[model samples]
Target: MSEDIDSRRDDSGATAPAPRVAVEPTPQAPAGQAQPGPEAATPGAATQPPFNAGNPYAAQTQTVAHTVVKTKTKKLPVFLCSLAGMVVGAVLVVALIMTGALNVNRDAGTATATSEPSGGSQTIKIDAEDTTLAEAVSAKALPSVVSITAWSSGSSENVMQGDDSEASGSIGSGVVLDTDGNILTNNHVVEGATDITVSLNGESYEAELVGADTSSDLAVIKLKDVDAKNLTPIEVGDSDDLSVGEWVMAIGSPFGNEQSVSTGIVSSLYRSTALPTTSGTYIYANMIQTDAAINPGNSGGALVNDNGELVGINSIIESYSGSSSGVGFAIPSNYAVKIAKQIIGGKTPEHAYLGVRLGTVTASNARQNNLSVNEGAYVGEVIAGSPADEAGIKKGDVVTKVNDEQISSADSLIIALRSYDVGDTVTLTVQRGKNEKKIDVKLGSDADAQTSQGEETNTDSAEGAGNGMSEEEFLEYLRELMGNGGNNRQ
Candidate 1:
């Protein structure tokens, strides 16, 4: 419960909801491509991975994977980190109950309410007799997946002097969004990068950063020196149509290996977790969980269905040895596209904000606190003049639902809020003592909340550092700060 307040206050830069998932801490390669060294450490910092003295941009090692784990009985410690050259950590807890039916039903509602892409029209129906399903999908989707390399210059003056040694870079993957040369990848992949290069079909071109949103861990980069006509855009799909046990393919670079493909099944859906970083806590809600072998350098890669249609963005993985433990997560295409569009439109990506401290409702806590509900989001503190306070939501209120969606725990509440955008109106069902009441509150923007509260919006300005720490040092620090155990692959 104390951890809940520490994690959830990020809505106002005070505290925010923490994430769960236990793997190991490992740095993400630029495109899931293999670097010229042994496996790097996971970003959760459970254990330190061997550092390659030759490669300064090696992945950091740590314990737990990058996703936060929440159970009805307890909330596990979240060690979610970025998988890029910077330490990316997420935890994998097998204790999670696979909620397939719940995800399908929830996503069904999203499909009707949101104008997401229906890739059914573009889904390629291949005759299994003619070729294997993987072969067909790979042939169609291979052109749409590209390898990305993000370079960070040590000094502006040194970069101008053509000092390549002073520059550090990481590898990750990207999905071609359009023929206009727009590509979508994880923000962590490109964060702190001054130079970016994209490799497509064995050709390389320079790219420019369009924009980034740290809260959602999504970013858009545009090719600056490439011909749009030569680009092949990937067919987008409706992620709300996904079901548990469905076949999916992960295409990306792992350990600098470009255009690699791995097969797996959708293990779970609607997985909500957060990665607390020096910049801020990244909320990964309503995610697609799969058993695909997502490894370091697979960040920003493509997670497609058998039809070669893009369904999600490969982002994080869970492992204890800084390798794949058959637990990986992706951002659903619907939400990823929504955030990407906002960045492309030159708008700062915003997350819905409900200014209130949260604690998970559990049997022990409920009994100790004399609460009626055993499962729900218990309000600990409400920020003054914030949405929750403005709506007359009092402390100790147990939020059970958001509109038709049931809020089973504090994490669920965070996940539900993510389904909505800033300025959207939502009806929150609360349990006060034995009385139940519904409160309508217009959601506010986290960006606005930060501004009003005079919080730092710049990611580089975090951790009392005016200039952000280098990716290499950041990973080392993450391993130490988070803990020294488990080695995550991504």
Candidate 2:
């Protein structure tokens, strides 16, 4: 019995205790309050909860909460870091600009506006005032400028010397003044020219002499078979308006150099100089002075204004070395137009002859001749039966003025008379024996008077009515009266 009891006890001890019924404690709202479905266990206490089928989503709620906490912890740092980086970059850029490391010109905006391209605007901004002047002048004046070439055969003397007998050629310039191919040039350019040719726009044609005034050093030529289409007439400007220091331009063939251009200002005005024409006559008086670089071949070229109008014609240059010395003289376009009009109208330009030989009235001449007027043209001799004699002008009359214009010297009177025609009437202010007298006289043609005088003298001498002198002696007497007595008989 004791052994069986002990075996049972051992079996009982080996067997697990009776399964304890697990009862979930109610959830406590507070520390001693009645609990709900389940109760919370105290710290370090173990509790068993019965399987109550309630709160099915409780486990899922806990998992979602835990996941949200982990996401916040990781993403917070990355957002803060990106924000900080952007702020730092912006600060650095501002600092660089503030420091003097960057250069920005304030005037860049204005310059950029000016650099824009012009769209078909006719107006252009020239660099200088004179540049604008040259542009305006060249545009209108270049068409009227013509190039001239003259050729003449060598003389018989040159042919017999075993040299080339070919004709020598020279080049100059001219200005087209009319639509009918009437051109104006210096007399020296066409003088002794046998074959004269005028060129314009690469075409050349033979020319004919219309008339030449040696006293004014002006000549007019006409081109055959040329019309208004080939000719560009120049606009005549007033030279009387030209002031000292006014800008001017010259176009010519300098040194036989074609289409050369030069520019300068008016150095002086109304300058008088002596020029000898190819006809052996001396042209004395009024010229427009400029520094426009006129050379030998530049003679007869046009001096243009800023508006490209013809102001003057390049006539002569005062130089010693046969080159430009910055002293150039031009015949005023005013006078040129007058001469041109006569030649173009088929009227021969006849200068008004005074029939009196005069000299410069210096202080010495005035005292020697007992003249009251100090500055006047002293009358040396007066031709009989001439205009002066017909007007009661005597040998002792001192001319102080012509019409209303004052006469500075004998050259001034000659220059003034060249501006008139043969039948023109002139009013002379003569100072005779301290009394000024005004006389109006009608001029006569010198050509007709000379021819008549030659015929009459020849007839008188041939009939032995005068001094019984030979033809040579009568010719010598006539030559002496014409103020050229020193040359031997030809």
Give the alpha-carbon lDDT of every model. Answer: 0.71, 0.64
Please report, as a residue range, the 10-residue window in candidate 2 with the lowest summed lDDT: 1-10
Q: Distance from true position, residue 175, model 1, in Å? A: 0.6
Off by over 4 Å in 1: 1-129, 153-167, 357-385, 395-411, 421-425, 429-437, 444-447, 450-490
Q: What TM-score quantifies how close candidate 1 is to the native fold? A: 0.62
lDDT of 1 by residue, 179-262 (tens): 678899988788888888889999988888998877678999999877765777888888999999999999998878899999
Off by over 4 Å in 2: 1-131, 154-166, 278-285, 360-376, 384-387, 400-409, 416-490
Candidate number of the best lDDT: 1
Q: Residue by residue across 1-490, what tens digits does model 2's lDDT show? A: 0011111110111222233458999755787774544575565453455444687655432111222434336788889999999999989877877996644432212100010011111223333424455665665566678888776676333544766458665677898876777889987777777878888867878898888766566789988998656666776778889989998999887766666778999898877543222233334345678888887678789998775667898876644334566887888888777767776676655556777766656576678978888776666667677788888888878888888888755655665666566778989899899788999978766654433443573242221101022344333333432232221111
Residue-pair clashes, model 1 = 90
lDDT of 2 at 242: 90
Q: Candidate 1: lDDT over CA atoms?
A: 0.71
Candidate 2 lDDT for residue 459: 40
- Clash counts per candidate, in order, are 90, 7
lDDT computed for candidate 2: 0.64
